[model samples]
Structure formats: C-alpha cells, structure tokens
Target: MITRSVQTVQTNPDDIIDIRQKIAGSWQEILSQAVTNPQELLDILGLDQALLPGAVVGSQQFQLQVPHTYIARIRKGDPNDPLLRQVLPIGEEMVITPGFSFDPLGEKPKNSHRGILHKYQGRLLLMPTQLCGVNCRFCFRRHFPYEENTLNREEWLSAFDYIRSDTSVTEVILSGGDPLALNDNRLAWVVEELAKIPHLRRLRIHTRFPVVIPQRITKELLNWLTGTRLQPVMVIHCNHPDEVDADVADAMKLLRDHGVQLLNQSALLKGVNDDADVLIELSERLFSCGVMPYYLHLLDKVQGAAHFEVDEQRARQIMSGMSDQCSGYLIPRLARENAGASGKVVIAPLYSLKI
Candidate 1:
C-alpha cells in the first residue's frame, strides 16, 4: 500500500512487501528518521485504523519510536505479529495492574553515584544517555527517571571516582535507554575511562540497537569497542526470531569477528515469545549469528506492562521445553531481577524440580 524510494526490494504481489527497502545512511540519520507517529506506522504496515485510537493513547504515555529497518520485519496487516506486538502502543498499557510499580527493580535506591547503579557485587551500571533506537512498549524503565541518572562528560568523573574507590568492582556495564545510543566518541571516552581503572576487567553493554538499527555497528563503533583493554561483551535484547534478518546477522558477525563477544538476552513476554517453539527457533537463530543464548528474563513487573508478563511457573515450564528441544549451550538461563537482590536470581526449570 505504501511505497518509498529506498534500496529495498518488494516481491510477492499478493503480500504486503513494499516496505522491504535497503536501509542506508548513517545510524544517527536513520535514528532521527524513526517513525514516531502512530498513524504513520499504521499506514506503513497497512494496519487497520481501529487500532489507531489505542496506539495514540499509548504513545501519549510513552512516545512510540520504531526504526524503519525494524518495522520492515513485521508482517504487515497482522496485528498479532510478534515483532509488532513488542513496539505497538496498545490500550492495555494504560491499565493500572496490581503489583506493577513504576520502579520494579528499585533502581532509584541503588543510584549510588550521579549516573551509576551499583546493584550487584562486582559490576556497576552506567547510564550515559536516555535514548534508544526503538521504544518497546514493555520496557521496565518506561517510567524510569532518566534525568536523574544521565551523566555529562564531567559528571562521569564522579562515577569514575566511585568505581576507583571500590577495588572490588571488576566489571562496568554500559546501560541506559541503550549505551549504543550514544555516539562513538562519547562511548569511546567512557570506555577509555573505564579501562583506566586498574580494577575493571570487562565492559558489558546492554542494548537493542543491533536489532532495531543494525547499521549502528559502524567501523568507528568497532574501533572503540575493540580497542579497549577491558573485555567487551554485548548483550542484545531480542524477543522473537523475526527480529533477526540479514542486516542483523551481518552486524552480529562484525562484532564477533572483531573479538567482541556476543550474547542475547530475551524477555519471556506473553504474546511475543511465550511458546516453546518460538523460543527454540530464536536460540538457534542467535547461535547461527555467532551469539550464545544468555538470559531468558521473566518480564519485570513494571507498571503498564502487566499484559506482557509470564508467570514464574509458565516460565519454568517453557525453559524445560527449551532444554528438551535444544542443546545445553543453546538454552539460556531463566532469570529474574528482584529488588535489593545480590544478583540476578536464576529460576530452575520444572524438570529439574525432581532432582
């Protein structure tokens, strides 16, 4: 229905394949061009107008942002498309579900430094920016007070001081809206600073950029990522197999080829990837891309995202099924983040219950 003059190809005249254009331009340019309008997204996907009302309301609460590269992967006109379900603003987000709070992980109390979250024992999290390529509707930090946590160049010194004082800290995690959201120069400076600390041994980045905008993994980005002495580990968030395509595969290969370890962490969302078969395929896809399955997180109980949560029992059952179908290395550990916990709590599968 909608056509654009980009480097994409469209075949299968009966299917909605017009949006499949090659995504070019700088990552920043593509990021700036993300589709924020609910109507525009509906038009591009050939979705019905009836869903617009809910989308408008949901976007009002948490602005809708999805990159064209990611949008092209969703099955047009399919409201329940797994890829679409993750980003599509829906009325259910406005509901006040019980037990779902604005701060599910109690991160505010853990904000030890200007932009640092020292929740775990040996590692700390730094938030340099509050930007992401795509804003998933089920984000636990949807209501996070990013303003209080974001740090400028000078402000980072205080965080560095905090880490320097704590010799026990051996790893630093770059997290936020997504650390990759920051430009290479900024990210390089941050990594360089972390590498200066004699105690820091590894630098982990948690981001969704590779899935949303694979082009984010540019040569300059690779230079900073691999140049650092601290071991680089990228934990990418990908829920469904549909999110991985040729572009994403290439990006992952680049990171791996450059000696940057690649790992995937997925959320056990209700409609997005609840079935055993879907999770199995996702793990296989990730392995083929040179990434190992790491964590299958039980959805964080954040306000407005209760609809996405899968119960602990069901999560364990799904893990059991994955263990049965896939190799041990391909199966991710089932984990959850409890407030004030020492570290991520791993949930044992149902089959392991008898043992």
Candidate 2:
C-alpha cells in the first residue's frame, strides 16, 4: 500500500487566497495561475514537510503544474488520496530502473515533421501546443522535446502540406501537452485548416482539459470543435471516479450534446485506481457522465515513473476481477503501447483458474 510522511503543517493563508482567486474565473485565468510550486501544493493540501524534499527534487525534472480547479477534488491532509497521488512528485522518481527511458514510446524518432508523429498508417499526430492544465506524474512524454516539436504558423502549414501529400492519411490526432491547452481561436483555425484537407475524415482530440478544468469547455470551443465537417472525437484521461465530479459531468454533457464522441483512457497506476472496485466504479461514473470507457493502459515505462507501474500479471488479474462484475460495454480494453509496434496491443484478462 502507498503511504506518506507523518509531519503536517498549517495551510498558508496567502496560498488559500491565491488558490481561491485562481478557482473563480475563466479556464484560461485558472490555468494561468496554476499552482507550480511544490511547497505551495503541499501547503494547500496540508501535507507533511517530509514530502517537500522529494517533491522539490521531482519538480526540478518536470515542473509541477496543477490547476486549482483539479486540486479542489483532492482530499486535504490525506497523503493516500488517489487524485493527489497522480500529480504529486515523490522520492521514488530518482530511482534509475532498467528498461526505463526518456523516450519510451520512441516518439523522438517517429517525429517526422516539426509537429507531426506519423507512427501508424492512415492516422498521424498533430501537436499544436506544449501545455497541459494538469501534468500527471506518469506522463510518457514527460521528457519529450516539446521545444523541437511545437509548430509556428508557417510550420503548421508545412504540417498540413505533409498531410495533404499523404493521401492515405484519413485521421488527424490533436495531441500535445494537450491540444485543448491552445485557445479556441487558434484551435478553430487549426481545425479549419484540417477540414480543408480532402482526405481527412475525423478529428480526434486527446485531452485532460475537461477533466481537470471543466470551465475549458466553453461556447467558442464547442463551436469550432463541432462546426467543422470532420467528425470530432474526444478521449479524456481520467484515472479515478472522484476525478469525474458534477462539474466534469456537465462539461462532458456539453460535448455530447454538441455531437462529440466521448471516450476515456486511464493509466493503471499502483496506488491510484489499481483495484477492481475502483475500476468498476470509475466505469459506472464515466457512463453517468456520457463517456464510454475506452483504454485502461498499462503504465508507460518512462524513466521517472517506474513507481506507478503495475506489472502485467497483476494488471490482468485486476481486469479479470472487473470482468466478473461489470457489463461488457462498461469495461475498457486492457492495452499497452510499445515503441515500434503498429498500435496499442490489447491484453485479455485471465478468465479461468489453472489446474
């Protein structure tokens, strides 16, 4: 079981005010004032001083950036909070594990263009921004060279030209730190440009914006997302049931009403939603919010996140447990991504006891 330090400190008043101010505004406003300091995050949650040293160390590798809106869902003073575990940096991150690397997915080599990753046939990734509202500790792209990949206006046109050149490319995936991190005006222009491509049939957005900052689902965002002729599909990243609150539900409903196909994908973290009960409830909660359960991903073996990994045998066992209780449609496919593999490999759960 995951545990934390015993020493606790009083919540800082200035921190409270800063968080409150960030909480009450447009999504951009909230994101702009995101809690970046490790001390500030620990202070806000009333966590122990023991966590600060490791957090400081981890944040140095990849800066801590959590929106106040998302922090609102975490349980104050509890070190074992599932939602907190996803964002909190820890001492284990320093441990050097074999088979773990900076570019685990081998995305660096596949980055064919400035912002394009054409790993698979028929579909290509178009990264528009290098920003995310909340940075999950286990993100595979934590060490990705965003500076090299982020596109300018001319570069975006170059990317479109590449897509047009490849007539086989039918789908364009908007990925990044998170594509929704870009403002609607820029996003709409990107979509409009994509729509101009004769071969493109769908626009898939992989984002955590709606989950972390519900207010990001604005009227203008919806207008562009649905206005284009290309079919819009959004795959949101949510690991636990608590992540999907009433506000998240409303954001999802807005998307569904706008005809966006909603699906969810989660990393199977050791202490966060690794149990069968939590996974079952998460599926039910997602269904209530109009999103279908999609992929339950095995942790990507990134350098700093080996602590979050659940080995395949254990993952299969947990999925088998979920299979026993949940209906077929509610259960997500258990999948893993390999660097050179054509696509995600689906792993079927253990169904019967061996002799």
**lDDT, each prediction:** 0.88, 0.90
Give the range of the ten consecutive residues with the poorest summed lDDT in model 1: 13-22
Pairs of residues at least 3 apart in sequence or in different chains that clash in candidate 1: 7-22, 8-21, 8-22
C-alpha TM-scores of all predictions: 0.92, 0.92
TM-score of candidate 2 to 2 decimals: 0.92
Query: What is candidate 2's lDDT per residue for 1-355, written digit by digit as tens?
Result: 9898788887642343334335578888989989999999999999998999999999889888999989999999999999999999888888889999989888877886899999988999998888999988999999999999888889989999999999999999999889999999999999999999999999999999999998888778888999999999999999999999877887887788789999999999999989999999999999998999999999999999999999999998898888788787888889999987768999866664221
Worst 10 residues of 2 by lDDT: 12-21
- The regions of model 1 sitting more than 4 angstroms off are 1-23, 352-355
Residue 48 shift from truth in candidate 2, angstroms: 0.7
Angstrom error of the Cα, residue 180, model 1: value is 0.6
